[model samples]
Target: MDKSQLLERVIELVVDITGEDEVGEELDIDLFEEEILDSMAAIELLLAIEDAFGVSIAPTELEREEMNTINKIVARIAERL
Candidate 1:
């Protein structure tokens, strides 16, 4: 899928799992700092992303620096794809 589509799906999954409608700011914004993503949320997001993209995300891939924002997450997934 395209970046925009992937991002939207991520946001939808995140919202569904977190029970929050607003995701806040832009894709570049740090989800942790925005309090929109925590450890639990991250796990849920990772699962959703994996299922959506049909790619497995290794646990070692959840680097804090690499996955701090939605844009980065999408980029990583795109690279894997």
Candidate 2:
């Protein structure tokens, strides 16, 4: 998928995991800071991303800050793609 579509899918995964519709409501919001994402949720998102896009992100590959926003997550996945 293209970058835009990839980003949408990532947002969907985050919303599904967090049950936070606000995730898409604010494209660059800090998920962890908002308590929308924690360690486990981040892991879940990584797995979903791997399933959806075949991009595997080891936890060690990026710090939480690097993946705290939807835009950042999409950018990380795009780099692997």
> Which lDDT tens digits does candidate 2 get at residues 1-81?
898798788889998999988788788989999999999998998899989999998988899889899999989989889
C-alpha TM-scores of all predictions: 0.81, 0.95
**Model 2 segments beyond 4 Å from truth?**
none
Residue 31 CA displacement from its true place in model 1, Å? 0.8
Native-to-model Cα distance after best TM-score fit, residue 4 in candidate 2, in Å: 1.5
Point to the candidate with the largest lDDT.
Answer: 2
lDDT of 1: 0.78
The alpha-carbon RMSD values of the candidates against the true structure, listed in the order shown, are 1.7, 0.8
Candidate 1: Cα lDDT at 77: 85
Lowest summed lDDT window (length 10), candidate 2: 20-29
Q: Tell me the whole-model lDDT of each prediction, alpha carbons only.
A: 0.78, 0.89
- Tens-digit per-residue lDDT, 1-81, candidate 1: 777887787777767877767663476878888787888888877888788888788767668779878678878888899
